[model samples]
Target: MAKEIKKVVLAYSGGLDTSIIIPWLKENYNNCEVIAVSGDVGQGTELDGLEEKAIKTGASKLYIEDLKQEYIENYIWPCLKADAKYEDYLLGTSHARPCIAKRLVEIAKAEGADAICHGCTGKGNDQVRFELAIKAFAPDMKIIAPWREWSIKSRDEEIDYAEAHNIPLKINRETNYSKDKNIWHLSHEGLDLENPANEPQYNKPGFLELGVSPEQAPDEPTYVTIHFEKGIPTAVDGEELGAVELVTKLNKLGGANGIGLLDIVENRLVGMKSRGVYETPAGTILYKAHNVLETITLDKETFHYMQSQIAPKMADLTYNGQWFTPLREAIGAFVDKVNENVTGDVKLKLYKGNVINAGVTSPYTLYDEEIATFDEDEVYDQKDSAGFINLFGLPIKVQAKLKAKNSAE
Candidate 1:
């Protein structure tokens, strides 16, 4: 049995699921009042008219919180500094959920709501993400997940319910794909994407919202210089921009060049394999540029260790919705320490479906041209390598001699 609830705050996006959930909660929760809250992480016009629609559906009031700058600075930049990528994914959707959920909790507390609601399905990873984050912030708040408790089994049935209740929805039964978009990236799932064998139709109209196909990209390449301060991208093409503006600018540039399109079947935290088509135009560009700067700035051991160990761990934590965990915070501190010297400039050429590194420079670069020169220099002695190699290969030579002696016997 569920606990009695009076007021519920819903994390609403005005999407198909969330649109229907407002009425469903009222019906199931004994006519409880529903206050809709939408977090604006650069969804552009998606929030337009959301207030009217939310109220028309069943919500008492709607709050659209502009979290774009906070989302970029707090969530996106830390993941970027950690170099976190889930498999081949740039983790655009993964990193946004916690920020949205955190805000939802805040609103619920301010409204004095006893319960919170989200539209995430039982089969997806988002339910866990939303619920865990809510628990972290407000442990006693009741969580209502419609998909888990309601009898509605499919989107088709949800559409029927919406029609019977006179609820307006932007998506219908014929909707080809389900999409989630923010400033950093846009993700596409469902429809033809359910079958991994079918190749994505990027050329098809409306299939891709953020970028054109590489074939459709301009013939000539475009060059952009990215400036980073402490591993966070600060500017593009020598123009200083804030976090949101920087990502927005790169999205347009990289999208024009068809730089970030990925078709991947990834393992969900719920122990299911799901296929998704992701467009991470700006994220793809920044990751490449930041990595190049790290190569020049970070010492050999730190760079190798980060690549081999820290990065994958961070990726796992972020992908699993463990952003609020202490381990993530500790790792973030270490990542920040590593990024202190990562300030630099990286030049990249954006061609069809490629972000090619053109140049990189940093004030804190560890590269020594004089010592690394092919010609003889005062910094190094050629004869020193002979002794070094002898010592380095001593164990190998001894093992070989022992093997030879044993073979002869």
Candidate 2:
């Protein structure tokens, strides 16, 4: 038996799967009201007419919230500061889900809805991301995942349903690519991308949206300078800008240079491998700049440990939707403390998908030229190396002596 649900708040995108969901919830839930909620995370032009479209599709009303700034400052920055990434993906969709889910929960409670619903399929990692974040905010709020319970088995079937219901869909069978876009990045999956053997036809007109492929990139390189204040990107070149503006500026430059495009077959948290092509122009540039800055500013141990030991953990947590957990917070605290001194500027040359470091500068830089230079210096490190090498090599020397004695005996 279906539970008593008078009203439901739905996570809606203007996509094919969600475009039909507003009407499906009403039809399946005995004419229950659906309050469709969409988030604007810098997916420019995607939010257009969402309110009109939602209401036209039997939604009681629609809420489109601007979550770009909050998402960057809270989600993207933390991951960047920790230098976190999963496989070949930059965690763009991974970071946006929690922010959207939190807003969905807020709207659900504010509207006094009986249950919360999402358009995420049961097989995808987004289901875990959405449901976990919803659970964190409203433990008692009943959740509904339409794809898990619905009879529609594929995107083609969803298009058919939309047609049957007289609901319009932006994508048809031929151009149906599962896509997620935000300020951080744009991702494309499904269609030919499902087959790892098939090369992504990036030059096929509409295949690559963010920028041109590296093959089509200009011959000349583009130089960029990024400034970091305590691990947060504050400016591009010498011009100070907000997070959104800075990222937008970098995106234009990086995209033109054919930067931040990757094709990966990653292991999903649902225990399945999936193919996705991601274009993260600004994120790629920022991560590269931050990594270069850290080399000069951060200490040997902290830099090594953060990138080696802690970054993968942070990536897993973010990718797995464990952002609200205590462990994530503790890890974030440690990252923040370590980044307290990571203030620097990094210049890079972006050419044909390569980010080559040109220079790095920081007031707190640990790179002392006097000690590190090959020429004669007054730091007096040349004579002391013999004693240090002897002590450092003592264990190997003792082991060699023991092996020699054993061979002689």
lDDT (Cα, tens digit) per residue for candidate 2, span 259-371: 99999999999999999999999999999999998998888898899989889999999999999899999999999999998998899999998889999999999999998
Instruction: List lDDT for all candidates, in order.
Output: 0.92, 0.91
For 1-409, candidate 1 gives per-residue lDDT tens digits of 2347889999999998999999898888888999999999988988999999999999999999999999999999998898889998988888889999999999999999989999999888888888888888999998989898999998888889889999887776776477999999999999889999999989998888888889999999999999999999998999999998899999999998998999999999999999999999999999999999999999999999899889999999888889899999999999999999999999999999899999999999999999999987998988999999999999999999999999999
Give the Å shift of residue 347 in candidate 1. Answer: 0.4
Ten contiguous residues minimizing lDDT sum, candidate 2? 1-10
Off by over 4 Å in 2: 1-3
Cα error of candidate 2 at position 199, Å: 0.9
| Model 1 pairs whose backbones collide | none
Taking all chains together, each candidate's TM-score versus the true structure is 0.98, 0.98
Report how far residue 142 has shifted in candidate 1, in Å: 1.0
Best by lDDT: 1
Model 2 superposed RMSD (Cα): 1.1
